[model samples]
Target: MNGPKKEIPLCEVCQQPANQICGGCKLVYYCSKAHQKLGWREGHKFKCCAFKVQYSETFGRHMVATRDIKQGEMILKEKPAVMGPRMSGPAHCLSCGKKLEPMKIKEIYDFYKCTSCNWPMCGPECEKADIHKAECKIMTDRKYKCTIKYEQPDKTEAAYCVIAPLRALLMKDSNPQQYENIMALESHLEDRINTPLYVILKANLVTFIIQVLGLPFDEDSILKVASIYDTNAFDVRCLDGSKRLRAIYVTASMMNHNCKPNTRHIYLGDNYNLAVIATVPISKGEMITLTYTQTLLGTLDRSKLLKINKCFECVCERCRDPTEFGTYIGSIYCSICNGPFGNGIEKRPMLISSNPLDETATWKCEKCDHFILSRQMFWGNNALSQELMKIRKDGPEKFEEFIEKYSQTLHPNNHLVLQAKLALLQIYGNYKGYTLSELPDHLLKRKLDLCHELLELADQLEPGWSRFRGTILLDLQAAMVVQTKRDYEAEKITKEGVQDELMESMVLLQEAANILRVEPEMRPTLEAKIEELTRFLQTPE
Candidate 1:
């Protein structure tokens, strides 16, 4: 005989008796469809995950794989617990987060105005967007009108700073669970107390919330909210791709940092729901990681940025290795040690940091033991970066000149040289006067070579389905098509040869399409290109 039947499960929303289990996870019960939908919108979508949260002294709270996860597998999808404008940027539409255009003298009051809070909004639909409702009421109730006039509309406004924090504070009463999630994040407030940004926030945001708006919150509490935003928020691109806004994801933010993280993320749809996808395979129990800085940056710059922004010194394998996993992206060539042809006895010894973790560490030549001051190297790279910026808009000629000038002193794969090559690659096929059909054979070959070099480095450093690699693959396939057509026109190859060459190009195109599959904005264009390429490949030569 069986024991007493298991008690009926309760609804997640109403806590009443429930028999219906969630189809996605099969763990939670809902009394009705309405309650189930409400539960998902509240939190279950994030809670249903293939990974689990774990704690460590090194990473604090971080996500770990619960099972062996395959590359390109969707690991987690979550909506932002809170979303708002970045602390500093041009005043944007409060509803859609799109940058507001400079208004004409007559159209300003009629079109761009939000009737509820007197804030800037794009249209009637945006003014009524649910995201703006809570903050709109607060502004209206307090009689605090937006003072931003149409005059000087292009200028960055400090007034925009209060919107995000205000929304977060309001969430304390309206959405306690989300407020708790925000509070659970590490703020590093003690370390940030005396910083210049903190001081500015205190004067502007804290004062406005307490004295001006009459909110029932103290200074530290408000500053903690700002600090939480600083530490955990992700830059979510607006739907139109015009600008980026700050959003705080509860579970997604818990992933720890790695220089070569195993996962990449994309914002899905207009809702800004984040989907974290594994870029590489992971064993069960392995820690899930994401890069906080650009993978293309050298160890010094990446480390410095992480320290300043995230308040943690990353000692990841890539950061500790001065050679940066043998790519030597940050190294300088030792011209004195190697002859012009390079000493044939051994590979050219590049100058690498003695201790990459220490900013003041000396960079010594591996072959001759010649040393240079770290400060000198730092400032030298900065100067070169500034020069590169100045000439970047001057076209491919300037890029080639910059690469040639720096090749003698810097390693071939140095970040600055790579930047110039990347710039040239973009220009060779896409820019006017340098289109693929217009490019000389020599220039076309240069573009192909740059694509190959960058892809090789990307595989080593970033690896898997990275957007950077996807873009390079797209360029590579286009160059291949152009080269093949040019060769066929020159009678350098037969119909069979042309088909063979294009088959290889098709493989690259397919891979690029796969990599960009999750990117909603890029997906349609890629699909159209794929269809076009398929038709061309199928046609007789």
Candidate 2:
């Protein structure tokens, strides 16, 4: 007998034995033209990629760079497999996820509603939008009218919770391939069950999908969908920033979390296509990473957030270092070494966690050898953060007071002080009465110093082509330009000195423009700034 017939590869979507392979990658198999389209939209278009998926015991499924990737090089771009409103939110258009304005009493009757489903939508076009069509049919078939009134447009609506889960459930029959892709994502159901959000989802979402909508899904299955969403969905801000929605991208979600991620992603256009780009040069075979938490957060806070939200403790290089790569953004200045209790020495001993990964770890002063409970440190930081939130709206004076008051107790580069300074950076030049032209020479210098300090911290913490760095670069360039002109007017600098400063500001602006190149909303503004700066620099002295 001939050797057993060679086993055929299975379709990626349906898993049926298949002969057709993707012509581009020749790596993935599809059963039909329809499934091919689905596969491409799901991720294969980008998966013929600079990276390849790999599995390990530590990182179950993650992407790895297949070849060297330069800074700002696009790694992957794919449309969201599923997108819908957040768990709870204000009234929003069912079609586009835009916040819906409250309809006045007279206009309520004429307000745009899906002709079939009677659900409020943005307009006639949205009434026929594909995203809303499936769910609208289900609600209409079940005779469930949306009772969400126009009153209290900003108040969080409990009824809005059902839309996303309902959409995911509808996928079971409406689109089996997408349903399979979504269900295959990490759910963390075991970890999520009986948690506060889990309980709320179960009581509100699960019950409604089963009893109210009359969907034939069990509580566990429904909650599993919610768990998948909670674990994997990206919080997408609408183009106008008026509303936030959630979307799941199968390939993008697989990258493991790192404190200092090698990659940055931006959502593009109305369809929310995501483009993941390398923030720094990535070597071949390196595992791809994306930060699930804010880069400005300290090690302890980062660990806490990752543990709670992503279901893992990050022991990355940054988290493992007590000094956080010497930035010491998380550490408190030791009172005996740097505070009033000391002899005013230049020594900068700091209190840092003995075990960064352990929540109950003791914090020991590097010089004084004094130890404090991690809980105590946590409470202290929490209180300070609360105070920071309160004074954030009070403008520059409050921020100055906050920085001065904590400078002795906290490390100079402490995350809280950095946050206060970042706030001041925006307020100093943009706020009324604090505009760049109105800003005094001393305050201008202060702003320049703040930019330098924060940019240095950003380089260490969130380095290279990052949105955070891009924003700071914009602020820095603006401050430099204003200060240079002020110095020129006051005769503090010569014409050549002015030329040198303007040239430096031009470089800063170009860097900012390059960094924000992939951002659609920022492109026009950046382009305008670049043109204006180029003209100024080229003009005669």
Candidate 3:
């Protein structure tokens, strides 16, 4: 009898049998020098095959600076070890994570249920893709058809949830070593099993994985796979034209959390790799961090989310400081002048803590001696929040009304106001009837002001080269360039004035481009804008 069949690693580029070996490191195989060169250009060269994926006692399995790593350095770039549609999300194709229009997929892409298994896939290419094959083979062997559809009470996710965990189980056999690596990662099963989702998981996932798919694993072990996904899965963003695809990274997941993170990551669409870059200098042996929670939220909100999701209370310097390191993203507007209540006061009260942390905290106006209870402060915030929520349904008229009404008592930089401003900014251009060309000079100025305000607040709250700042800066630059062009055409300014304006706008655009160029999807548009501005700037002043 033949011994166990030798495994052949496929070429990364063309997904073909690769007999030729990579000379740099023997970890990969390539079909030819041409494909090898293509793979290297696409970032296989930085795979860190020689470096050991080390473990730490303090932070668990984390990647460290073996030597001194500099700011803006690509610390890690990795394709997802396993990726699929997110739990509680809409229906999507299992292979590519794109939204599944079942009929459209069937008609246009020739997507069909596998002849053996009856699971959906775009074509033979996607049918045989690594993402689908293992799980597909197992499901087909067991004669499992996805009985669930888009209209179920779970709204497509009930059946979809099984795909990732099933992939985990299948990986145990097809790729045992990789399965071990994933198993070695933290699960936080004990923490997650206590949540409400577990009740549903028990009712659906447990039954399906054991009974429907006919896996031999015990209930506890199966749930462990789910908890691992809950605790560690990172949102992979839009990839392969798929919305909100989440992935598990063997190396990147090793990084811990920090409120004011020193590192930032960009998703490269070319090969589905995430590139982690240093936003600030990282010293040797320092634990690398990624903000698992949204940095845009205020301190109490951030803490609450972290506690609820990740099962830990953060004590980072940002969390410890009641004022959120002086950004005051959580602060209320001064009830009188709408200034930030503690403008210059040393003993200013700003959100000591939220529920479960503290019942209440004082909110005293240091300058004006206006006393508002902690409960009272949040009450006001809640009222503002309720009104802000209506803007989505009530439309632009309501947004302007809400802003004007709140401006009387709330600071422009108040979180609620910022939320409204952000909403309004998005609407002013992209929304129907509010096109940029249709906007008057004063309206353009208003849009410009909103961008500036948001950017200033972003600098204070979400600092460094952030997506929020980059997006707003691009909007600001675009608006300024349009306004400048209008001014020049109407003879409102001299050639020198137009040149000066273009120069100023170019600075902002360049900064926006630099911050955004790392993202593959964001690069082309920003590059085009930068080129347009550069051409305008070169014309005689």
Candidate 4:
């Protein structure tokens, strides 16, 4: 007997062989169907799958979270996803297992034909998608060839995977307005590789096209084609130990972008999931947002990121302010005129671009009654964020200053601020000497205050019952526990008060459990923690 036929871990959902492992952090395997459903329910439906481990250099080595992760707690840490050559040579059609034809020349590289249908194979499976079927007919009549490049066997250079369905997306739709949208998308797709909106759209479109084609957009099997620098790429270090093409989707893309997103997205190795959190107190039915670009950029850089990536002029509060308002205290309302400085007011100075022969770049605040050199007032926050990334390995001590600096420079209530704070909390709470109990009273109080402020912001920024909110509630409860302990030590509170505190902690802990979610392995630990806390609260002091 052949040893039970070697039970392959078939994805319960898609029933595909789970071959590809999540490279970000190895917590899930995706054959195809299982990964997609898991990604959707677990929040990896549209993005790359991620792992459960967080890379922390804060302790000078890779550090993992000690406690059960509350939802929105940073679990996996990684660099931006990198693009690489597809590992399997001669890209095969996912549906029919047919090989894709390479573009013979650069000018004709844009054209492709379906292997089975001969309907302009964008790649092998391109013939299967309904969107491509019509276009395939049209292309078959015109005999259009693609101008895209292909990877040669001799070299390791990365090549763009020719996507067939998108080509058909250019064909006119029945609705006049919808047709116009498709045409616009076609034009946009032509130059999308250079734009941020392209990255976002590609991520989303991959999901839609996969579903329409009736192909499983699973973690291990889905194909991705893009340049090395594309932002949508995932850092799959564990699977092949090198980057390769991976699919991302757009149905999840309808949500708008923000620098400080209230909803936290997680990858389940096959799909991405979105969980709402309070980046700021959010009201019901408000727009849920995610940041398409970093929010730390100055006014000029902010505008550039938005225009380049999202393809829209951000009229958001921060973009409109010349002073980079909401970033820091200095950039707020100018002192003299009571209007925001550098916002170009009647009395305040304007930030002018000086062209030695033309006009020099400088900021004048009519409201502030002063002018600041653009260079000093306009440092690149993105560059600074990169620097912070470098120092991330240094751990909690170094981050104290960064927290203060960033909070002062960026809006205290900004989404980046929240991410940074989460990082800070992880560092402080997880590190050996940086526990909240060890901090000086004043500093500890300040930390609690900051946590409270973050919760307040989360309430406004993500109104839904998201993991982010659950994580904050857990953090707040933990801080309160420490505070109560300190108060008891100082003889400021009675034993009964501490008991009440315990009760409060129990309620908050339950709330955290209600909202926070993690991988299957960690669920047991979270449940245990909740049970332990419940028992403590139930015990008579």
The segments of candidate 4 whose C-alpha lies over 4 angstroms from its true place after superposition are 1-187, 190-246, 256-291, 294-302, 316-366, 373-383, 402-422, 435-446, 459-467, 518-522
Misplaced by over 4 Å in model 1 are 1-47, 107-111, 150-154, 238-240, 338-346, 392-394
Q: After superposition, how far is residue 270 of candidate 3 from its true place, in Å?
A: 6.3
**What is the Å distance of residue 317 in model 3 from its true position?**
1.5
TM-score of 3: 0.79
Give me the runs in candidate 2 sitting further than 4 Å from their true place. 1-47, 107-120, 150-153, 392-394
Candidate 2 C-alpha lDDT tens digits along 177-258: 9899999999999998978988888888887888888888999899989889988989888556886789999889889988
Across residues 229-320, which tens digit of lDDT does each residue of candidate 4 receive?
A: 23232222222222223322222233455544555544444222222233333333344455655443344555565555444555554444
Predicted structure 2, TM vs. truth: 0.89
* Tens digit of per-residue lDDT, candidate 3, span 1-541: 8899998789878879989876544567788899998899899877633223467665556655544556566677788777776775655667776665554443453235555566555556666776777777777777777643434322545567777877887777778888888887788888878689887888888898788778888888788888888778887766345556678888888777888887788777634688887766667666667798877666656766787777777777777766665666777645543445434444333333333244255665534656567667667767777777756643466777777886556545667767777877877766667778878777788899999888877766667776777889989988888899898899999999999999999999888887777877787898799888899999833
Q: Which candidate, 1 or 3, would have the higher TM-score against the true structure?
A: 1
Q: TM-scores of the models, in the given order?
A: 0.89, 0.89, 0.79, 0.47
Best by lDDT: 1
Name the weakest run of 10 consecutive residues (lDDT summed) in model 2: 102-111
Q: Rank all candidate structures by their lDDT, best first, as comma-separated numbers.
A: 1, 2, 3, 4
- 10 residues in a row with least lDDT, candidate 4: 351-360
Candidate 2: C-alpha lDDT? 0.85
Candidate 1 lDDT at 92 equals 79
Evaluated against the true structure, the overall lDDT of model 4 is 0.46
